[model samples]
Target chain A: MKARILVSFKDSVLDPQGQTVRNALHTLGYDAVQDVRQGKVFELDLSGISKAEAERLIPEIAGKVLANMVIEKYTWQILED
Target chain B: MKARILVSFKDSVLDPQGQTVRNALHTLGYDAVQDVRQGKVFELDLSGISKAEAERLIPEIAGKVLANMVIEKYTWQILED
Candidate 1:
């Protein structure tokens, strides 16, 4: 099975790296851009598992090792492989 | 209008930041994690624009100021108010 997971800070959270990017954008002349938030993308290849199993299993994986739940939230999708 | 965009290096491309994260994970005791890739996410609140217009225009925005074509690729989706 294959999965693509995206984890990010919610809108309400402050992102220092994103603020830096926004500042850089302004310097680069993209003034229309008002805000930027940075996140992590994980593309996983789990050969022995089924997509159904992955969906159930990944939340635990994400909770335990993939994301810091205090500051991050995640969503995942099963991929066609 | 609201739009969410995500930008990342292609799987074929090497990610130094991701590698760093994987190394950190190993040190923190996530031995099952083989790799990690980092990316950027943008949650845009574009007022005075229609979702349709935002979707049509974001490709140009992403291409011009959001991501470097040589190193990154991105996808965007319209959001409910």
Candidate 2:
């Protein structure tokens, strides 16, 4: 099994990096782009674990280590490999 | 319309950060986690554009500005709002 976690800033937080990307796109002629948000993706390879176990583990792992709850939130999914 | 771009290092590239994450997970008692790979995600909001036009623009934007073609690979999808 494999697990994927996406960690991103909450909607209320300011994302300066995303803003910079939007500005860069404008300079490059992509005027249609109105907003940009950047986030992190973590793919974990789980060995010798059942899907049920992985499902239970992912939340704990993502919550405790992968995301900063004060400003960032995370979502995770398990994949069959 | 919205577009999501996922950028990750090529499989052949070394991911020290990922290794660090794996090590951290192991320390935290996640023994089933064998490996971890880190990547980036970008969500862009498009305004005043048709789906076809947004589709055409996503690749150019991801390839030219969001990802480093030499060491990274990117995948994108368009979303309806």
Candidate 3:
């Protein structure tokens, strides 16, 4: 099975990288741009877990490797592929 | 209105950052970690545009400011306030 994960900083978090992207685009003359926040995407192939087990296991996976809960938050989806 | 944008490199893309994060996590002793792909998320407070207008505008926004189309792919969503 494969899963897709999205990881991001929580609301109160400071995102310098996002700011840089915003500035880069603004400098490139895309002035209509408002904000740019960046995050992570993960595609994974799993072994030894049924789809049922995957649903059960992923939250723990998020806590384990997908995110640093103290600073970031994440969401995941089991891909049909 | 607010919108969330997710940006990532295409599958054929070389993901050095992802590899670095994976190495970092491994060094930190998170061995169960597998693939660590990185992406970007954006949140924007859009003014003067209705919710409907936002939905229409975001794709262009992604194309213009959020990502470099030659190397990255992206998706976006409107946040419900």
Candidate 4:
């Protein structure tokens, strides 16, 4: 199975990278862009595991290693079988 | 409106960051993980633009700045009004 995890900053956190990108976009003439928030996506390929097991383990993996829970939020979904 | 851009390495490209993360996961006890790929997601907030306009502009922005077309691919969608 394959799974996808998305890790992003909490809404209250200031994202300097996002701000930098936003400014760059403006400089590049994309003035319609108001704000930008950057995040990460992790795609995992799994073997020797059933989909149910993967589903159970993904949250744990994401919490412990994929994201910093105090400042970032993570969401995940099974992508393929 | 809000738009999301997903930028990922092309399949043929080597991802050192993903490999490092995979190694870390294995060391951390997620042995079921076979491989990992990393990507970026950019969330954009736009004003004075219609969804249709955003849809039209996103591809241009992604291609020109958000992703390296030679070694990466990007997809985007409008998220909200």
Highest DockQ against the true fold, candidate:
2
How do these models rank on lDDT, best leading?
4, 2, 3, 1
Candidate 4 per-residue C-alpha lDDT over A1-81 given as tens digits, one digit per residue, 9 for 90 to 100: 899999999999999999999999999999999999999999999999998899899999999999999999999999889
As a whole number from 0 to 100, the lDDT of residue A77 in candidate 4 is: 95
lDDT of candidate model 2 versus the reference:
0.92
Model 1, A19-46: lDDT tens digits are 8877876798556557767777776545
Give one digit per residue, the lDDT tens place, for model 3 in B9-50. 987998898788678666865454566667776776566657
For candidate 2, lDDT tens digit of each residue in B28-49?
A: 8899999999999999999998
Please identify model 2 stretches exceeding 4 Å from their true place: none
Consecutive 10-residue window with the lowest summed lDDT within model 1 chain A:
A43-52
Which is the winner by TM-score between candidate 2 and candidate 3? Answer: 2
Encode model 2's per-residue lDDT on A1-81: one tens digit a residue.
Answer: 788898999999999999999999999889999999999999999998888888888988888899999999998988676
Tens digits of lDDT, candidate 3, A1-81: 677777888868988887887788668755555776676677665556578877876676677866899999888998863
Give per-residue CA lDDT, model 4, range B1-81, as digits (tens). 999899999999999999999999999989999999999999999999888888889999999999999999988888889
- By DockQ, the better pick of 1 and 2 is 2
Query: Which pairs clash inside model 2?
Result: none
Write down the TM-score of every candidate: 0.74, 0.96, 0.71, 0.96
Query: Per TM-score, what order, best first?
Result: 2, 4, 1, 3
Number of backbone collisions per candidate, in order? 0, 0, 6, 0
lDDT-better candidate, 1 vs 2: 2
